[model samples]
Target chain A: MDPTDRETACFEAGVKFGALYHQFAGTPVSAKNADSLETAIEESIENQPGCSAVSVDIHTDKLETTRGYTELTGEYMDVTLRIEYADCIVHAEMEMEDGYPLMRVVDIVEE
Target chain B: MDPTDRETACFEAGVKFGALYHQFAGTPVSAKNADSLETAIEESIENQPGCSAVSVDIHTDKLETTRGYTELTGEYMDVTLRIEYADCIVHAEMEMEDGYPLMRVVDIVEE
Candidate 1:
């Protein structure tokens, strides 16, 4: 596939992974604690069997304000994580807009 | 040699092209007329020899405000331009922030 396809695949993988992870945690993924979520993902991939390495490439901050409250959340994290199969570059994005938890798998690349 | 290098080279080429084009026109390139600019570029390349095709892939708008003046500008134009010397996919981006003409060449891909 092309770069765009790879990016889309990575994004879908991230979204699926995020959903499964949230279900496993049994709590709403916290946008306020993006770092924690990032760390957890890093740790999981790093400690997993046959994994090579896991690292965060980019973590972006985004803020949205409503009439009564303002949310300081992350726009996206362009992360390059390695696994046993291959090096999977993924972008895990989280956004809280209009009091809604918007989690999206923005990108993935296998190199 | 790599994607990043190609992107950088393309960006530099676009910047040089923009500068030279501006000099030739004896006017500052207007962000307000992005479509016009895009059309001009398309016409230039399409009319040129060795150019298989020329198309504007993306155009974007942006707004910037100063202490007294609210200036509307363009954020960026992610354009994919084709030339005769191979199909050079170029992104011509422009942004005006803080009352400065922040013209940038963001990416280039030769496929």
Candidate 2:
């Protein structure tokens, strides 16, 4: 069977979450540049189709400064995505879960 | 409604593609480092849940050399992912599609 609108919306939401997390995960980030990274992530994901808004919070406070800068990963950030598709809108988020970056749908509204 | 096994598999594949693309994009890349980046990309995404295999190809020839190294993007690479979930397996691919990295499910089989 073909995918329904709801499922497509969910898939699109998942795409945004994955895209947001991976695209910037390995960037060299230090406390001084965390703000810029956050803004870049938000703008990057917002460029995706169906993505209305993106909010990224990088936990620079948790970053290890021993190396001056470290590769970014889920352990140092949280993200939320708002995706609208067809007649449905989706809210999704990502954060560390058992050391893995877990992306999940928070809610979906059909309107 | 709950997503079926097939839908979940597709979603997983999409996640890997997004993660693979985003996590490595913007990295400093030149002919000298493209092979290593390809290996790193394949290994990184293979760690994702339900992802069985990943193949990444970075086109060193297409890279702009004005700065000696260019950032990676859809225009510079192609990727394929294999994901398995609840007895269903999915094959997905990503490449430059009209100026965007278009990812789509290529096939899904149940076993």
Candidate 3:
């Protein structure tokens, strides 16, 4: 059977999320590098096929430490993102370890 | 800086999972259709860059129904997969709705 329009949109969103997750998870995070990290994420997601607006919320333990210590230890980041697509909203959450996103989800939902 | 061997391996695994999830989730499921689903998943993952072995387990609500009823109401499936790559093992879990994977993860680990 052929995929419905919704299914195709969701699948494409998943593909975009996969690529975005790789870009974000591969970066080491520290207090000094946080802005650049967010920027990179925003740019990648916004560039996706249907994404019109993208918001990212990132929380990491490494930001609490002194810059020197954070630079040495790196950070574990949890990223929550809401992306507005033309047809639906995609909500994504990711867990990062040693600067790599280990697990994640990108889902199209009503809310 | 270049990605380490582990990071590159993990990233490629993520890419494979993304593609596999799209393929699997787009198909409607029933008891009669489960084997084909598993076959598609295994073939896709095993063809990834470093994958050597692929296993898939699928559980669904629509399988308990009589075949006729199952054909009318598609199944909601949950897929758990383990893919063995040359460098690491990748475990993935997916939740499907109306025959599309809405959420998922592909993670590489020591186990």
Judged by TM-score, which candidate is best?
2
lDDT of each: 0.38, 0.81, 0.51
Which of the predicted structures, 1 or 2, would earn the higher DockQ when compared with the native? 2
lDDT of 2 by residue, B1-111 (tens): 445677667667767777777677789999999999899889888987898999988889899999899988889988888888899887778888888788777777889
Name the runs in model 3 displaced over 4 angstroms: A63-75, A81-86, A95-111, B1-111
Residue A30: error of model 2 in Å? Answer: 9.5
Instruction: List residue ranges in candidate 2 displaced over 4 A.
Output: A1-5, A24-44, A56-73, A108-111, B66-69
- In what order do the candidates fall by DockQ, top score first? 2, 3, 1
Predicted candidate 1 versus true structure: per-residue lDDT over B6-82, tens digit per residue: 32233233323332233223223344555676677566645533334445422333323233223222233333333
DockQ of all models, two decimals each: 0.01, 0.35, 0.05
- Could you tell me how far off, in angstroms, the CA of residue A26 lies in candidate 1 after the best superposition? 71
Evaluation by DockQ, superior candidate among 2 and 3: 2
Deviation in Å, model 1, residue B4 alpha carbon = 9.8
Please identify which of the two predictions, 1 or 3, would achieve the higher DockQ against the true structure.
Answer: 3
Per-residue error at B95 for model 3, in Å? Answer: 26
Instruction: Indicate the TM-score of model 1.
Output: 0.25
In model 3, what is the error at residue B75, expressed in angstroms?
37
How many pairs of residues in model 1 come into backbone collision?
Answer: 4
lDDT of 1 at A109: 45
